[model samples]
Target: MKNLIAATYAPMHTDGSLNTDKIKDYSQFLTKNNVSGVFMNGSTGDFTSLTIDERKAITLAWSENKSKDLYLIDHVGDPSLKVAKELAQYASDKVDAIAAIAPFYFRLNSIDKLIDYCKEIAICAPNLPFYYYHIPVLSGAQLNMASFLEQAKDNIPNLAGIKFTNNDLIDYGHCKSKANSKYNILFGYDELFINSLPLGATGWVGSTYNHLAPLYYKIKELFENGNMEAAADLQSKAIKFVELLNSKGGFNGVGKGFMRVLGVDCGPSRFPHTTLSDSDYIEIKEALDGIGLKSWFSK
Candidate 1:
């Protein structure tokens, strides 16, 4: 659960069918690159683009490839509480942990409501740990997680921590400092992993971890060695890498395609997610090299 945890993309064949065949290789690829965990079926995995059966197949695939080195945290969030519960129950025995975001359709209006939503889902997997995926920009449930911890701490018995995916560093710091530092506040702003260090964050979950793990580890190493200038420089380059492709189109799809440059093709993105041509990637690679990030690509 600590260190870099990749929010993996769902591998698909050209026909847009689930290609669970590559799950093991994906796991090994991540492990070889120094990634410690895989956070599956999250936003990066294009969960919203998948059907219930396909999602189930993904869970089964990852579960079968589960290893001691790669901790799996399945994001079981769905707009329907019933569906989220089903997903939670389905992933209960399969993953190392389970997480759910607030129901986005009618989004939970209060911290209490969110707690209630999480409690039901957590109870479904009573034996396993539960994480609340707090990404307000997407879910529209922008409550203070510090307050969430105050109210939810005792209520949800298995509330392991949060997949904190926002830039409210103030509230994030509060969550980190809450209740004698009881919860595992996994920082989610990939571009701001440098900022999290000052706040005492050790774990992070992000999609870019899939591409730039070794680079991040080097950043961590440099920072811990008192080379703030070098660490911040690399961190800024990483941020630039995201901005570069994000400028071309949307980042999610472009970034997913960049996985192939590192020798693992995650395949074409689904509808609304643009898949780049090999030439597009080649051009992007040239752009990456221009910024002195050629060596950072995951291998």
Candidate 2:
């Protein structure tokens, strides 16, 4: 799962039903843009808003749509151990890998508990590589991830690495520097991608990649070419893009809707995630075009 892995949106009908049918075009759109994989049903996929059946349907759709050009990393986390386990088992045969965040409802108070929780889920898919979805801001389990790398390294047999989604550079740096550099610490904060490049981050999984893979790939190219100034400038524009959509309603809703501007209509977001009017998208299109990010989308 190196390079860009888009944490994709759950395509839905306006009536809030899962539109799993869209995964084929979605997969092709991603591959066309050079995104290497899909991080299915993660935060950006609005997993929390979906029912277990719905999430499973989403997983099955992605699994069925699997291609040589795109890998699938299914996020199987759920507050219910049974549900998480079930999803993990379901993904075992379907996806290239599986991932789970700490159960967020009650919260795991200790790293030991997190390891136990992850281990249980991970064992269900022993054949598939597992990644701990470490997005503490959303999960509320802010245990030191460096310690997770140290502790979990030996515990979870299928553990491949961390889908690191926080802003703590110190901890991130420590995780990347883990002895032998075993894990695939997939940096998830899209805006901070350029910053992670210097630390040797190769794989990145995030929502914005669904919309701006070309832009980010270019950013990586610029950074790799020693053009720090241009990379930083593009990175700033990405932040601006998120902030701009965020101001309209919320970024997840607006940004997912922004996919239409990129030529793939992911349809409306689920409940609690505001859906925008067509006019809103028009205004967003104008705003993004004004900022010179129009060329980043797939034509």
Task: Give the poorly placed runs of model 2, Cα more than 4 Å off.
Answer: none
For model 2, residues 1-299, the per-residue Cα lDDT tens digits are: 68999999999887778889988889989989999999999889999999999999999999888899998999999999999999999889899999998888898889999999999999999999999999898899999988987888788978899999999888888888883457889999988999899888899999999888888999999988999999898898899899999999898999889888787888998878879989888988899889988887655
Note the residue pairs that clash in candidate 2.
none
- Model 1, range 115-135, lDDT digits (tens) per residue? 999999999999888999999
- Residue 101 deviation, candidate 1, in Å? 0.7
Q: Evaluate all candidate structures by whole-model CA lDDT and list the values in order.
A: 0.91, 0.90
Compared to the true structure, candidate 1 yields what TM-score? 0.98
Error of 1 at 203 (Å): 0.1
Which one is best on lDDT?
A: 1
Q: List the residue pairs that clash in candidate 1.
A: none
